[model samples]
Target: MTAGVLDEAIKKAAIAWISVGDGPAYALWCMPAESSILVVSGPGEQFAPGLAEAERATVRLRGDHGGLILVVDATVSRLTPGSDEWNELAPPLATKRLNASGTADELAARWAETGCAIVRLTPAAGSAVGAPDLPAESAAQPPRETPARVETRRPFRLHRVRKR
Candidate 1:
């Protein structure tokens, strides 16, 4: 595994897409620190239910053309707010966002209040997998085309037919 390169990619990418089991991929806002990816799920962020309880998860930092840039098979764990682990990690994630909070401390407190869960995805060894390219998913479920409507209006004569 290219640990150095993967870690650097993680640090550079502000968000990574993650999926668990056969579930759909979710756009997760993340911060990479200490060889792990930090993500928070709550009221406003992308919803990732059952992630904390899941044993293993997949984190992908994608590149152009739907290609997988860095794929990490990670172990998922939950960090309860106010713990030492939470203290060290959650604040940095909060700070990464523009409107999170004025300070990390305040955001941490908010996380506690809202029952948000901080998920830590630690990449497994030999899991810095890369893919050349992936076909687009638009074919599987194509978007529905909507019909255009023309405006309806009353037709008028130039001179109202000389007032009839």
Candidate 2:
């Protein structure tokens, strides 16, 4: 896809799931900025521990089609706090994070206080692909009915008494 289209898609996508190697991945609350993807990892959020040392990963973008728009082979980089990069990226990150916040100052302050780090992913071989197809039968089944009563008030007895 063209850079313009890619940027637009990333900007509109609110969440992206990142995968490294064959390990399990977690969702990222990320946004498109400066030709890269910016995501935050801290307390009370979902993020893979591997990303801290990962060299490359794939960023999955759910497409309008019934499939995924995968941006493959993205180089992972961490943006240090209080740097020029952080200063510029933080505003857009805060706005995207608190998408509904009337003001960003409070959220930004809280983010700093809570020690949040912004990780950047630069697409090396950006690609879009179809989502894996699964049979309808494989879908989750509804819960089955349960018994009406689970316990009784009578005390437990190890042995039954003979007719008395």
Candidate 3:
């Protein structure tokens, strides 16, 4: 799916699941937490496929400690499976709509059809855990291009009177 499409999906899901405002369309990031998962959506190119594919289909997430897989649905205005967009929004996180109930499989299936995927986070096994850190990996990466700067020039220019 296209980055924009995936971003829209994430934003919608986040709004549905979490009580977050739809500030802008961007890539999504999440990490394990003590109680709930910490998620952050930002502007980015796309996600990883293996991540997206695994999330799209039903799959259990296992780690050294333990992990929870939340079924989520993310759809943008346009997203086609195996398209460039899909490739970009790879390695999608499995997130569920806030206050959603029912079986994980059911939720995942529903989301998958809409071009969204499931994300499973595995905690470090056998370790006493606290709150999970937010995933800032993407944040550290530089933008592909810098936005253009606007220049405000004076409406009129004054010539030197004495020089002439």
**Which candidate has the top score in TM-score?**
1
- What are the per-residue Cα lDDT tens digits for candidate 3 across 1-164? 22332233323332222211222223344433322233322122123334433222211122333332222232112234455543433323323333435454444444445555433322222322222432323323344444575667857757745765
TM-score of 2: 0.64
**Residue range 22-129, candidate 1, lDDT tens digits:** 776677888878778888887766588678688899887855445457777889999987789888887777888667546977877787798887888888888777
Arranged by lDDT, best first: 1, 2, 3
C-alpha lDDT values of all predictions: 0.75, 0.68, 0.32
Q: Provide TM-scores for the models.
A: 0.73, 0.64, 0.25
Which candidate, 2 or 3, has the higher lDDT?
A: 2
- Candidate 2 lDDT, tens digit per residue, 28-68? 77888867788877764445667857788877766666245
Runs in model 3 with CA error above 4 Å?
1-48, 53-110, 126-139, 145-164
lDDT of 1: 0.75
Which number leads on lDDT?
1
Model 2 whole-model lDDT (C-alpha atoms): 0.68
**Model 3, residue 162: displacement in angstroms?**
17
Q: What is the TM-score (0 to 1) of candidate 1?
A: 0.73
